[model samples]
Target: METILEFISKHIEMFYLIILMIFVGIELIGHVPSVLHTPLMSGANAIHGVVIIGSIIVMGQAHEIISLILGFIAVIMGTLNVVGGFVVTDRMLEMFKKKK
Candidate 1:
């Protein structure tokens, strides 16, 4: 467990990015039915929110200035992707709705 944590701590940025890419690839592969795509994407986007908040916590705990700064940047970028993705997903869903 400790070893896993150490590796994760050392390579957190890569880990976060890999997870994000996996979600994106899943979305791109068209496994989600069109009817469920937006909700699925929105749900998946929440994962980024977790990454952002987690990075914030890590930044607060970090002692090294460089790591702290990088973590802070990660928080901002991750949050934008999460929130903006949800908004975009919602719009995509709305586009499929029948017009009045």
Candidate 2:
């Protein structure tokens, strides 16, 4: 849509920063050993909670139906991701716990 295009144009710098960060994150993760992946993913899940909040804000402010629907879906997916990440992290950490 025209509005989306205009918004993206106006915030092009933000988009560039986001893209750059994505690549940087991927590169960093690529170098991490398998042992550290669980902790890293747990941290990412906390960060994704922020994404859910952002999506909620978008859903609240979205005037167009399509935008609202997309935002809602984003929130749902983010929630699922965060919850799953925490569960996996907990299971991984449990293996290291000493017997009582």
Candidate 3:
């Protein structure tokens, strides 16, 4: 569609930056040691908590149905990510404890 193409053209640089970030993130994460994973996951969960709060604020301010729906989805997904991260971190910590 012309509109889609126009939108893509208008934000081509952003697309390129996103692609670059994806690759960089993959490379960085792939190289992280397993011992550091728990800490990294905790940090990621903290970031997602902030994202969830921000999405809630956005949803509160949204006047359009579409915007509110998208914000709600973002909040749900962010909360899931944070909860999952905490669960995983807890399990990883358990693995380090001595078994009685």
lDDT of each: 0.79, 0.83, 0.81
Task: Tell me how far candidate 2 lies from the true structure as C-alpha RMSD in angstroms.
Answer: 5.4
Pairwise lDDT winner, candidates 1 and 3: 3
Off-target runs (Cα >4 Å) in candidate 2 are: 1-37, 98-100
TM-score quality measure for candidate 3: 0.53
Model 2 alpha-carbon miss at residue 13, Å: 17
lDDT per residue, candidate 2, 1-100, as tens digits? 9999999999999999999999998887888878877677786776667677788888889999899889989989878877877787777778768547
Clashing residue pairs for model 1: none
Residue-level lDDT of model 3, residues 1-100, one tens digit each, is: 9999999999999999999988987987898888877777775675556667788888889999899889889989878877777787777767668656
Tens-place lDDT per residue, model 1, 1-100, is 9999999999999999999988987777566567785577686786557777788788788899899888889888888978887787777778668666
Tell me how far candidate 1 lies from the true structure as C-alpha RMSD in angstroms.
Answer: 7.5
The list of candidate 1 runs beyond 4 A from truth reads: 1-32, 46-48
What's the best-to-worst order under TM-score? 2, 3, 1
Q: What is residue 36's positional error in candidate 3, in angstroms?
A: 4.1
TM-score of each: 0.53, 0.54, 0.53
RMSD of each: 7.5, 5.4, 5.4
